[model samples]
Target: MPDAPLTDLQMKQAAERFGTPLYAYSAAELDAALSRVQAAFGDARIWYAMKANPNLTLLRRMQSAGVGFECVSLGELARAVKVEADGDHLLVNGPAKSDEEYRLGGDLGATFIVDRLGEVALLPPASRVLVRVNPGLSVSTHDHLATGAAHSKFGVRPDQLPDVLAALRSGGHTLRGLHLHVGSAIRDAGDFAAAFARVAELHTLTGPLEVLDVGGGWGLGADLHGIAARAKEAAASFGAVLWVEPGRYLVAQAGVLLTRVMGHKQTGRDFTLLDAGMTELLRPMLYGAAHPVQALWEGEATTSDLAGPACESGDLLGHDVTLPAGAVRGDLLALLEAGAYGAAMSSTYLTRPRPAEVLWDGTQWVTMRRRETAEDIWAAEV
Candidate 1:
């Protein structure tokens, strides 16, 4: 992987303007990623998985890019609608839905993704749904991110699946088709084909099932060969209208977490501390996933640990990470490939303020979200 170096002025300017622990992105980077998705799907409806990062700015940006949304909550549905999501295209996929939220999503024209017999009866009239099925399969990814397992809480198990077809046949619900979210960060083509084969076997439909939503978890900036090949094969195998929802793969490589070095310390071993932590970026602790991390400088660089200021010993960004050896306090460090969940997971834990966010448009950088202040925390408490 090519080291993403920062221009001398850009680093200095970002540190000067946005402060440390800031999250930065490139409009061009995101645009290119989305463009690739458009090219790959080629008419497949891609709904931005809002649960990945629901910042209004990110949602609005995706909306403007001709993408719809996959929402799971009342707030997300409202946000998607507020941002002018096409009424016919909004997708709702969640286990629990308050009766009010159910009506709201149905009334707003969002397509419901059903996982329970209870939902079939509770869903409002005229509501359309796609049966979410568990193919008794698994995809190779982090254990925490694997949602296709039989024990997973996300989808319908094969035993319970007959109940779904029975409900669709007996109940007055409009069952559109099937919805399957198998895994996240999938990397192997054969693995994908195997998963597709299992899900494709469900196409022996006997009713009004027309559209098949193969939820997306394609790995981005890592390897497209696996998913690209499987996608081509799946298109041929299913022979039905297909839809995919890709978030991290579409935006991860397009982002950078621009945090400044807070201080350096040497205990049992050498360490570099930053104002960031698990609060700012939680993937490491949450999934033990490694994000490509690097320090950007005007000249040379070295590998170092980017430690978060959080009290826990587990609060590390990247271990044995490459950074500038000469880097010191206030030096700008760009944690590359952080576009998806970086800023969205940040919190006011220990009263440490979360940082601002910016978007680089290649020609210029624009401040998308201002840094959180002390009172921003206090105001929420009251």
Candidate 2:
């Protein structure tokens, strides 16, 4: 699915099988991502961030593989528990967790990564906690995704650790270890290594750390093997076992949002309308991301920009892109690099439904997540 690797015949087949505007994934690719991330971090524990791709099938695969779960909200918590992941391996992160969510996490025996002092102090006694430290280290990703700096509302500031931990300890909070995530899509492994050094210093300063999780963002290089190797080196000095939370690095390469050209029109410059809109995939409009588009069945590919079928002027999958030259009406197009945030963030805006999702199992395609329909939108209606 990465780079829209879905072939013309395959795209057409998928559209025919599951219907158009399908958000399909490759099971082989997803498994490969799991294998790569596991290989990168070495033998340490890995809690696949279920928020990345929470499709029941994906969760089932991760659960069966003995991976843990990382939840940011109560809903995510429920999703993990539904799969019956081992309680010991469940980790709850993110700031601003509701009181009920905290209670649920504690009752579920999932490790809670404490972000704020207020919640830490208010937490019930004997709470299992991992202090999420805002090292003031910058992840250098999009501001929306950066979460480790002091400005970030993510975790407790470094200066506040002493007082925060004192309260938790006094409250009988079970101190586990220190956790820090500089940011998302981290391009530099050295930055990660340096961040670990800072975390180690914290552990030494605080006492002994039982666990250390360097929240994973993608590494600098795009090469999967290189990415894994980099992650292994970054946590080399930490005495405690290391854990990583990778979402995009694990799923981005393995998925694509398959769309079809419903209508083609020429603007003063040139514009083509796609059946897939921002409602389905918003990375381009939201973050100006690069989702390499490919044409299946269309011979050599032509130089044509593919814009998502959204009314917004900024709704575009790619601009002035090149696929097969002969690609015309009904030609299936593949939007690569959609696996991470595609279906997870989709909406039913503009009255357009999201695509169905299928997983390629090497032998054949399996329906991992069924397509959404009109009934899906109103399923919760009174």
Candidate 3:
């Protein structure tokens, strides 16, 4: 397992300077993660799934590192454009794409990931296309993360690929290749092997293609070499170049959510109240994600549920978390592996201001985004 990106003293410094409910990322860790993927994928094109952490600063870093951007919405496309990413470096993907998204993606000359047959007609004329294939294989992950499952509303079913391809070609669009993305946070290599095997079977129909995008969903601890080997074989079978879009795998372990302990209580379950909760980090309440927590102070160990300041009971961060018995108000707690979706999914619920973000570049702290103010939240309202 990888260590937390920020050091104890660094986290403490950030918390003190930026206030609690903050996000701090390590630049060194981000580079290391990108290097690992490049080393494993070797010649395969790497497109950073911007949804993981779409901060403009991070996006610029990725673009400078020669990583492409995989965008799912118009806003993401705009972000990619803001980074000055050309069509070659941008891949527009989504199950339900809006007209504006299509127009802008088309104008940018991005290769679109067609999810269904109907999308073939909706795409920009002569647009570059990669047909998303739904392998329909069960994967080892949260049900919500299993995008390629038989009934998930993500990709075209295996049986529907031929029709999709035919539609694209007849519509005068360029068919770049086939795309297979089983799910996110997948821990099992066999799940990938099976999905690749399923995709490999489509070679008889697809013939030789230009690119085969085996989408990324490797768990934080997943074996990249093993998964890359299978992905290589699948692309080889199709006689196409390999591409990967890694979202969380590259950024998740590089970020820490810094929140302060606000209070403690005991009602059947001992509770450690935090300044940050679902509004700041919703994975725990939404996907039941369990991030490792580390306390800065030292004392006797005690187990308690980490609760947030929300009025709802489901806003808990962790259950039965072990922390210092001497912890008190203003104490700091670091939530590890929060670099990916933590700030990207943050909301201004309860009209609370969102947290600020900083990046540790090994030399000094750089503020990436300022904390939202109460006035900023409703500034656009009439």
RMSD of 2: 2.5
lDDT of each: 0.75, 0.74, 0.93
Q: What's the C-alpha lDDT at position 212 in model 2?
A: 73
- What is model 3's C-alpha RMSD? 1.0
* Residue lDDT tens for model 3, 1-382: 2257888899988988999899999999999999999999999999999999999999999999899999999999999988899999999999999999999999999999999999888999899999999988899999999998998999999788888988887999999999989999998889999999899999999899999999999998888999999999999998999999999999998999999989999999999999999999999988889999988888988999999998999999999988889788999999999998899999999998999999999899999999999999999999
Pick by TM-score: 1 or 2, better one = 1
Model 2: how far residue 15 lies from native, Å: 1.9
Q: After superposition, how far is residue 240 of candidate 2 from its true place, in Å?
A: 0.9
Worst 10 residues of 1 by lDDT: 1-10
Q: Local error of candidate 2 at 121, Å?
A: 2.5
Per-residue lDDT over 1-382 for candidate 1, one digit per residue giving the tens place of the 0 to 100 score: 3454345466557767877777777777788888888776677778888877777878888887778888888888888878878767698888887877788887887788988767788777767888888776666788787787767778786567777778866766677778888778776545566777777666554333567787877766445545655655554555657778887877787777777777888777568888777988888888887887655544465556667888899998877776657766777767776777777777888887887888776777788888888988898574
Query: Whole-model lDDT, candidate 3?
Result: 0.93
Clashing pairs in 3: none
lDDT pick, better of 1 and 2: 1
Candidate closer to the true structure by TM-score (higher is better), 1 or 3: 3
Query: Who is ahead in lDDT, 1 or 3?
Result: 3
